[model samples]
Target: MNMMSYAIVSVKNNSDKLNALLMGMKGVVGCDLFAVSYDDIYTVVSNVKGANLIADKINALTFAGVIDTLAQQFTLLPVRFGSLMGSADAIVKMLERNRHEILQNLLKVENKYEFGLKVFCDSGKLMEELRLKSGAGEKMHLKPSPEIKNSVYRDYLDKKLAEHRLEESMLAYVDAVITEIAGRLEHLGAVNNFKKMVSEALIIDAVFLLERDKKAELIQVVKDLQRQNAGLRFILTGPWPPYNFVDLDIK
Candidate 1:
């Protein structure tokens, strides 16, 4: 059976506590969970046939549940769902090889939780609003100059120019929102990452990692942003494990 790794935990000197914790928990499909330790770190894992680790929803949830349970008791770097090593020895070697990176990442995420924010808008409505605000609407609606009014090439160029301006305006609007979010989160001392304009409707996808105690402030900040941007919808989720903040890649 291959070992399916769940999380790399910092147990420090309390390996026994981590061991006892794993002893009481079962992994996906009733696989008994165990820890492979090196120095002060432990990788929680379970044995399974390589062929049985399906990527279905049940398996995914179960895998996440294991990590969540462990996170409740320890500061861990949550491994991606399908991470596996050929054997316990390989896992040990992996832990050894990646020890420095592992410790650094674990320290970064220690006592922190990741929260996600998605900003959505009705693309047509938002675009129209932006065009109106930027006076692009009036320009697009204006009759062409007499010299170019009947020229198809000039008409096409004008249409393309208007579209380009619209696109730029939309990007600028998204960037402004991102800046405001970063500013608000800065005071909370949270680290944030943002993706702008994921789709026409989804304007912003952002994640923040902050101390566990800062969740309330984060939620309130999102609320203020939502109130201020009535044209867009904001959705905030999680005080979850730092899935997006982990910076380690195991060998």
Candidate 2:
């Protein structure tokens, strides 16, 4: 059976506790969990036929649970799900080659928690509200008058231009909200990433890595942001391992 890896962790002097935790926890499909180490780093792994691993919700959640359990006591770089190799010796050699990148990644996530913030809004309602606020429905001077120009092509261009302008206005509104969020979280020394307009209703998908001690403050910030942006819905989730923050290439 091949070894399916879960996460690369900084175990250091905590091997016993790591082992004890693994003993009580379950890996994918009732398989036993163990660690393969190089220097102070360890990769949590389980034995299973590589072909047997399926892409399903159950397996994904099980893999995340293992990383979640380990993150409680140690700083770690979460390995991608379904990462497998031939044997423990193969894993060890892989670790040896990638040791520098792994340690650097571990250090980046040490003593931190990753938090997610999603801002949602009714797209139609929000755009209308912003239009009313900005007087955007007012006629623009840039549009060529059909009576003066007498061209069907110009009318079509005008319609497309109006649509483009409305989309930009919507994005501008979202950016304003994101700016305020960054300002508030600035003092907490969080590193943040953002994606805008993920769906019709979801305005923003954001994640940040903050010092672990700032959970209370982070909650308060989200609460205050929710209160401030009455038109938009803000949902915050996590104290999770740095899943989104890991950036490394195994050599």
Predictions: Cα RMSD each:
2.0, 1.9
lDDT of 2 at 61: 95
Reference-based lDDT, residue 47, model 1: 95
**lDDT per residue (tens digit) for residues 63-127 in model 2:** 99999989988899888997889999999999899888888888899999999999999899988
- On the 0 to 100 scale, the lDDT of residue 181 in model 1 is 93
TM-score of 2: 0.93
lDDT of the structure predicted as candidate 1 = 0.89
> TM-score for each prediction?
0.93, 0.93
Score residue 98 of candidate 1 by CA lDDT: 90
Which of the numbered candidates is closest to the native, going by highest lDDT?
Answer: 1
lDDT of each: 0.89, 0.88
Candidate 1, residue 165: Cα displacement in angstroms equals 0.6
For candidate 2, the per-residue lDDT at 95 reads: 89
Q: Model 1, which residues run further than 4 Å from truth? A: 136-150
Instruction: Report clash pairs, candidate 1.
Output: none
